[model samples]
Target chain A: MECTDFKLIVVGGSAGSFSVVSHLLAGLRPDFKLPIVLSLHRLKHVRSGLVEGLSLKSKLRVIEPNDKEKLQQNTVYLAPANYHLFVELDGTVALSTEESHNHSRPSIDHTLGSAAYAYRDKLLGILLTGANRDGAAGMKEIADNKGFTIVQDPLSCDIDTMPKEALKLFRPDRLMNPEDILHFLNALPG
Target chain B: MQNSEKDYNYKEYLLILKECSPYDFSEYSDNSIDRRIKKIMRDQGLNMEELVLKTRTEPDFVEQVVEAITVNTTELFRDPDVWNHILKKVLPALKHQKKINIWHAGCSTGQEVYSLLILLDHLQILDRAEIYATDISKKALEQAKKGQYFYNFNAEKYRENFKASFEGETVPDFDSYFSADADKDLLKIRTDFSEKVQFIKHDLVKGDLPFYNKFDLIFCRNVLIYFQGSLQSKIVERFHENLFPGGTMILGSHESLGGFFKTKFSKNGPVYHRTNSFHFKY
Candidate 1:
């Protein structure tokens, strides 16, 4: 799929995501204009300071979004702990706990599926190192919507189950290592 | 009236609520609604019988009941762990952004907004950020704009929350957070931070969004539960439209968007993002 109009980039992971995200952000330029949404499965009971921890490594603006909060370009949005985050049709960020899917409040499928529905052909869904099959159907949904889909090369993934599962469900447009993924992302016209 | 009569009357009272209030308590979890009504009745010094009878006749009584039913109990930094998380995980990511816009919905009495301002100040990024605090209640917005609170009310709680969430060794003095008059109207924020936040009266239910400015972060905690499913979805969709491509959205600890919108975000913890639609698989 051509990613010409794809402005939103969703990255989903769970176990061993910190290193992967760091690598991805480190590879991108500081002035990268695309919006990046990170959905990391976290313990519902613990305080997840993923945004603050990741902020130290990247030059982009990182934040925990609020209700009715508008989305901006070139920022990193971290899902708050114990809440499911969704993108509103208007392209703003919304948080909810209305219910749990995949037994996770901030389910990767929920986020990826929503974006696929909202952005259609312009969406790019990425599933990286993760433990569960949370993102399998979501990757398919992105493809079904004619949006671009990418999975971390399972051989290189810390936990290969998620990317492997996604690959089984659908053939993604790109399957590359972290370094190559960066080159691929940088090559995209914003 | 018999006990059964009282039960029927209670159901009728709830029906009246459905007719008058925007929220339909009929479909709300029964135990929760019962608990709220019981608390309202007890607080108003009225037994169930009296409450039912009085509510039927008093025109303004429904408004009181509406107020009692709505969830208005919010404190500054209501959840310190979340604040701690933001401090440790979120703010440092945006150090390079030239300007930041933060929307604080349900910013009742401005405590949360001040708490945020303090957080930004501590990070030394207060000058680069703009805060928009909006709420449906005019009275709450006015109080937030005033930026004052009573010392004896919940001052201790605020201080404790702040201390617990703060990352620095020398916690900023609470006095620095606010100023006070002889009458005890403790203005919780300095003018600079206060000025940075633009206060507007917005009804998330009916009216249009106030500003056209796209925000970097939006904090809408504990506001959508009051709305019905459709309204909640509509508002969430509106929020999506208001944001720039990579902005963040934060919700209350207990809230989620399961029934409302699609999730295109990478979950960090409490915050979500509208992934830049520009990044497609090459």
Candidate 2:
């Protein structure tokens, strides 16, 4: 449940959170080495634009990784549209089109829960401003696995349903504003 | 080795299944296969021990287990933009060849093959094309050969995908390509389209090339996502060996050749144009 011990960082969001995510990414240290995986609900029909949008502010290279691609350091990997991103027990990620869970491909729960399963206590799971309950069980899974879980402070969210849902399921390790989250990540030890 | 306890169990489960059946998923990406295994356990209401017992005792059940393990959740023209690119760009580029050869590795339920057929037919070049498809799952190969799918599962989506692929252009009579029975809730790819395709039970992970001749293009979309990174490279390398010098390899939209393979196959827009210009380190 500590910042420096994490091997991977997973962030999940749905509605009204892109700007917040951009802001957080804008503030992250350029030297950040932990592999960050972002799973956001997107227009599945549209093939492009999410990476372009996120790349505008990310300090590290933002890529929609190919399947079976290794989790690389100093990079931000965004889940591609129409695919579920599962973190493997090995140091790679696999993509699947298995009937979308919770009505969304690249399901946040799948990404977060799989990361929790793969990295256990070496993972940090974050739930951001969103209108859906897709990432609630995933945050609890992170907590159960002794990994750190951070839910954005509900009062500071554009839509609080996602964080509120997570809070209802289990107490996470931290409740912070986007700025605080950025600060905590930036201040992490080697 | 952090979760060695669970890892040990999965290794045992895989070994037991391999011992009893022809299927071997040991090289598959662990999370992808393990997650499917967990679902199989739930759906069949068998714990790991009982599952292994069933696999041992029931020869017939092994086939079902293999089907479940391999993910075959494809839809007709799942991504229209990619199909649009194929129809407009990739297919027409192969005009020099008198007869084009195509191989669809892991052709699940055959929707993609049918989609390509419809395109090639529109281009009026299907008569001179040799189409072959292969899948590890015999059941999936049978369904692909049958050329039928539940209406809700693929029929309705077929029309939608057709329209999207030809967004600006006036799409042809898409209905003419297929026959549908709403009462039976089944849709069949017309005999004309289905007959041109030859389905073979070729396992990409194990089986050798089903055809001796090299292909002009290989469509292996979304199939490599199931294997480990090492296997992904190996599979792509195998495709390189099976392709004609100037042939193109069309992978899933999100996939690409990594490491040394990147140098081997050069990406040109939507497809990887196989490059034979250099003979570098092996």
Candidate 3:
């Protein structure tokens, strides 16, 4: 199946990912049908700025979904701060105040791993720039689930710890920079 | 992945839970349930079969498993902004009431209970307030009754949150409601505050309301996030039914009411007000 045929797109990132994520969202056409779920590491005490910042750069609506909110196409759902966002089989988001993994609430590994399980081969996972290894195991989980996996190129990142750690696991399908990622997603089969 | 439960499926485990205990967690969100089960197996050094065997044979052990399944971590002023909103906005409306009944459903470990107690005290209505706190886990209920915490775990964060909630208001001295034992690293709730709260073991998913008071305010925060969507709706409906007309119920910040509840409660963030005439759902 073509990449765009996937039911969900989950992007996990931490440090140095803001610019890359912004670039990717900025370049996507307004008609992009794939719902992108973001599990970004954010300051737990600070909650308001991320979606507002990202929304300014993208045509698609960026949201911090309420617990039990249904997934919608043409929308970008950012994980709410201090909660883990799990994509349920019924296609609604379940937020939990459960223990943090890797010292991070809204753990990328959790969001990506759960999406891999829920969407299986219909999931496209993007592990982007960060200073930690949180998304690496999740990226591996995506690969193991036969889902499409993309890691942001280390050379193109502000901090390479995330993708570099991911590379140590199974090789992802693509190691693309911001521009390549944008273009590839734009050209995905409708 | 160590000593993994190869076939201890959630459905089977839930069935075991239902048979062995009064608790029914089949309506919990699947991923949270799955992870908690794995954690239980890994921590206790029990395989799937051993875990199931223990649960089926030992009533006490099943209760322990239920304790392990329930997530119980909460802090003083965990979400200070919400508390601030409650203090500044929600609690004021109830200040003049002759009597106030408040229930904390799934009041894990009691930080949230004391947080509200302080608010009631600040409003000078602590004497008139009837505070009932209940949780499914006996261990948590015991801790809630004690109303004590490790100072190391609570001091700094508690101070910070307390400050945030009373930002413009006169901040009380730290020694007023709690005392810190430096050598023991313990934060003991002053008896005056602890004695007022009546802690009970109530399961929001299974058991009847701990007491039927037609509560004026309810706080079931962070508890329902573990629940499945339909369960979330059902529990919200239950809270709605128990809420007095024009009463307020606060849920977790991340949680909101769905289903016909979207129309039943007037929402201001997680602060939901019971509105309109009551009707039985078909």
> Which one is best on TM-score?
3
The whole-model C-alpha lDDT of candidate 3 against the native structure comes to: 0.87
| Model 2 agreement with the true structure over B1-282: per-residue lDDT tens digits | 556777788878998988888778888877778788889999999898999999999998998888888888787887888888888888888766698999999998899999899888888888889999999888888899888989875665678888888766669887788788888988888987787899998878874886865989899999888887778877888888889987988889877677788878888877887889566755
Candidate 1 vs 3: which has more TM-score: 3
Q: What are the runs in model 3 whose C-alpha is more than 4 Å off? A: A1-4, A44-47, B1-8, B181-183, B278-282
Off by over 4 Å in 2: A1-3, A29-33, A44-47, B150-160, B167-170, B179-187, B277-282
Chain B alone, model 3: TM-score?
A: 0.94
User: How much of the true contact map at the interface does candidate 2 reproduce, as a fraction?
Assistant: 0.76
Kindly report which residue pairs in candidate 3 clash with one another. none
Better of 2 and 3 by TM-score: 3
* Candidate 1 vs 3: which has more DockQ: 3
Against the reference, the lDDT scores of all candidates come to 0.74, 0.86, 0.87
Residue A180, candidate 2: C-alpha displacement in angstroms: 3.4
lDDT of 1 at A114: 71
lDDT of 2 at B155: 64
Per-residue CA lDDT of model 1 for A1-190, tens digit only, reads 3646777888899888779898788768888888988888875434556777888788788887765466788898887765667765678665654345676768888788877866788787788988888878888998998989889998888889889889888899989888888887788886
Report the C-alpha lDDT of model 1 over B101-120, residue by residue, as the tens digit: 88887776777788888888
* Pairs with backbone N, CA or C atoms under 3 Å apart (clashes), candidate 2: none
User: Worst ten-residue run, lDDT, model 1 chain B?
Assistant: B23-32
